[model samples]
Target: MVQKPTLAAVTHQPLARWIAYLNAVITFKTPQGMRLTNQDLTHQGHTVRATICHVGPEPADGTMLYLHGGAFMIGDLRMYRHLVARLGQAARQRAYFLHYDRAPEYPFPAALDQATTAYLALCTDPAAGPISLVGDSAGGNLVFALLHRICTRDLPRPAAVAAMSPVVDLRMRAKSLTTNRRTDHLVPTSWARRGCTAYMGSADPMNPEVSPVLGQFDGAPPCLIQADETEMLADDSRAMAAALQAQGVQVDLQMSKGLIHVWHLNVGRSPEADASVAEIGRFLRGVTSRETV
Candidate 1:
């Protein structure tokens, strides 16, 4: 069997090159047979890029808004096409892969604001049907941060939400950051901190919008969190689950052993990745069904 390249192996290169490398690999590895279309979402005069992915002839009744993870500094819609399509196919929904602006250049509120804009636009469109949110790594942070924003703004909430290997605590207080440092092949503490710094810019890291673990999730919808037990961000998921439960939100935290961060990216090739996506699809479908009922 050909050995798969670890994220750490390629991330050492320059940002642009690394992103190109991953995109090339993902494009080649993604399973064929999904219809994809580009659609731009505009709200309050701001436009956000989004790609819609679906399978079969008829459109599904709901939307799954996917936020890709690249530590908030990298990642794009192309790299996530496979995962989004598979999840959408699993849940019987048309998935929208959001291409939010990156940090260091765009910074803090840019991505958040764009995400909020896309979500609100989706909420208002009757054709969007019931909407659910799914994000990974930095995107996971957005999922929760967006939830906080929705709750505070008194906006319509998503029917369900899922975060995979999310970086919820920007405080870097999670013990797993040290404990699983060597075990996690995808993210290093120093690299994660750098990404956080780039995304935060002048913002305080502890601000709930920056580090969603610190945010209040009152009235948030049911959430499903999945993380690698041995990855550095494990505690982020654990802590967020506790916090959400305390806030009276229904939370399901699933921890997998011996997997790298955001392993769902390997959906077509890895059994574990396929299983994780399937599980999330089921959770989303179930919750969204209840929401519409």
Candidate 2:
């Protein structure tokens, strides 16, 4: 059996600076041999910056829009560069990772709005064909929320979507909250509740858009969800897959035994992480290839 790596303790009352430093420590190495560029776009009249990563001279498939996870409060362009670059390499696709505004400074709809805007910007590019969505943790929440919005508003839909340890239910109603709390190194019930409350202020957590576990997934793109079986958010991914399936959407949910939250972010460090990225590439290829058929 492959042993799962233990995660570092979650910071007590994580602030932006604390979380940023932690992310910097975890994502220590700078990515090499990739073409990285900066692009600025306006989202709801606010400037949004995205790090565009290219693995080769030209992408053969399409572009991936990536959103990072930091409890909706931290994680940024510099923190995620290496992981996105690895994803670009493994997936054979260019990646556009957003540095969306965080909570307490910008809450709830702010991040969602920026994500939608950035996605729209990508849609305008003729070269960005069969766009796919990828995100981890809170960004995974944003990915599902954005998919709902796109379906509701009749916007251009992504060809496929993938998420890692997505926090699907803001209400924290999943049984794993109690069942796996002690074992799941990253998220404790109290800590998760606090962050969700901060992001959801005055808004109903049960609102489907706010908690995508409650949302309809009819007409949603083929979706892939990955999570650690022992993590607190395992139920979130499972329930999300069930919800998507109930709505007649194609969904693939994998709950692996030996991994921590968003372990795929480990990039070059872990063999499991590398395998997960390759699986993502396979999933994306399966979905996008069908579109051309």
Candidate with top TM-score is: 1
What's the TM-score of each model vs. the native?
0.93, 0.90
What lDDT score belongs to each candidate, Candidate 1 first?
A: 0.85, 0.81
- Residue-pair clashes per candidate: 0, 0
Error of 2 at 51 (Å): 1.1
* Per-model RMSD to reference: 2.5, 3.4
Tens-digit per-residue lDDT, 13-58, candidate 1: 3655476556557443565777789999887787888999766545
Return the lDDT, model 2, position 57. Answer: 52
Q: By summed lDDT, which 10 consecutive residues of candidate 2 come out lowest? A: 1-10
The alpha-carbon lDDT assigned to residue 253 of candidate 1 equals: 100
Model 2, span 1-293: residue lDDT tens: 11112122443434545656665776556665767899986645666788887664566778899998877866776678777877776666788889888875687898998999999888888887788999999999999999988988888889999999999899888898789977886665665776688788778888888998888766899999999999998899999999999999989998899587788867678889889988998998777777767
Off by over 4 Å in 2: 1-19, 42-47
- Ten residues in sequence with the least summed lDDT for candidate 1: 1-10
**RMSD, model 2, all Cα superposed?**
3.4
